[model samples]
Target: MKQSPAPSLPSAEAALPRLPDRRQSVQSAQTGMVVLKGLANIGGNAGLTALAAHVGESPAKVHRYLVSLMQEGLVDQDPATQRYFLGPELIRIGLAAMRQAEPIRHAEPALIRLRESLEVTCFVAVMGNRGPTIMRIEEPGLPVTVNVRAGSVMSMLWSATGRVFLGLLDEASVRQMAESELAAATDDMRALLPSPDPIGTLQREVRAACCASVRDTYLRGISAVAAPVFDFTGRVCAVITALGASGGFDPSVDGRIAIAVCREAHATSLKLGCVGPPPAAG
Candidate 1:
């Protein structure tokens, strides 16, 4: 039988295992970068789970890496919530890195312009464990207003700004965060929520509006509109929100204001040399 035709050689393509698409491989890498950068910016244990899901990894594996990071002092744990945060090493790293980040430096002026344009209370907030921490606030020109000051911490599950920030995060991550906070919160705190489904529903709405602008009604008589702000890598770095008296500013107006805020934020990002996908136009 001519030794089975000398045993035909396998083709080069057949010799190799099926490889993942190059585009998919690139996306996987990018996803990992996004998760890492998000964790660095947000600085919380909940972020690890989010990052893991974003990269299609298990939380335990992510936790192992985080633990190693902690051992090296690149991360720390919060005593109150036992959540992890960027440690002293990261503080040093961030200080050095931020030197090249002009957007963060110019955050105040951009926020000021957006506020002035909208003539509503505007806030520039950064992500945190509790929620978005108000880095700066521009009170509206109006006489009567809601006075939320800088440094005030808003609930990630409630306030408009916080919701916008949460919207930037992935669904599984948001759900994980909400559940963690809900578990930590008092019974009275849980009671304040609209319903058990609000967390998941709100998170879905927020993520769906990632690149697009979105608006929401918070307190009975208070409404605010917001847009997600991205950094050079197109990660949701911060959120700029416009708040107004529910009576004076109609919900429709809030939507318009969100469009304007997103535009201004995009301009600012451009000025700061941030390269990323432009915010969705209204």
Candidate 2:
């Protein structure tokens, strides 16, 4: 009898066991996670019946998972209400995840994607000692002509990137920087700002839009859209910006470029362990 043909490379690889496959998952552990997620989804404090309904499991089975999770310290129950809540161990794990989050590192890949997909210049800016400063820049094949580069300090009152930091952060120092910029600006430059309460207006508009867009404000002939990248603490740690020549760029807050920028910023914020809604382009 002819021997069976040797296994192909793909077949050989497939024969090896891989982790994270459903077949490799411990059933008990998967059930426990489902129960935990159900608890979290029901506002993190729910009765057995609600959790059971949420997970589409019998109360008895979900209870068994809950008991295992309790032993693992992943869940807890209130003595008075007999309701399940996310346990101290979950908080500890969350804190650990937050501690490892780095804003710039998480945002760099997003910038590159935005540059490639949208064909616009993109950058990540962090609030530096001087002001909002560019940390990384990603330019398209034909780069837009702008004065800013990596490490360049943006004008807190002028640039879309700087305005995003100013709008989200409630820091006295940041406000002071904006004030100083406003105070030192010439009549021509000051005219570019919103009338009758520029800072207040800027903050309101940015907060409402969940991002900032500028047309010929910071750099003449250059338009930009910027969105905030938040940390787990909900603080705006950095801003992601995309800019292009005004002739070709749409600077509307609700335009495609703004939406893409906000989506990337929201994704970066998620990688930084931030728990919040996506930036809505208003």
What are the C-alpha RMSDs, in order, of all predicted structures?
A: 17.0, 7.8
* Candidate 1 steric clashes: 0
lDDT of 2 by residue, 240-271 (tens): 99999999999899899999999999999989
Error of 1 at 153 (Å): 0.5
User: Evaluated with lDDT, which candidate comes out highest?
Assistant: 2
TM-score of each: 0.54, 0.85
Q: In order, what lDDT does every prediction score?
A: 0.65, 0.90
* Residue 105's lDDT in candidate 1: 55
The deviation in Å at residue 44 for candidate 2 is: 3.8
Clash counts for the predictions, in order: 0, 0
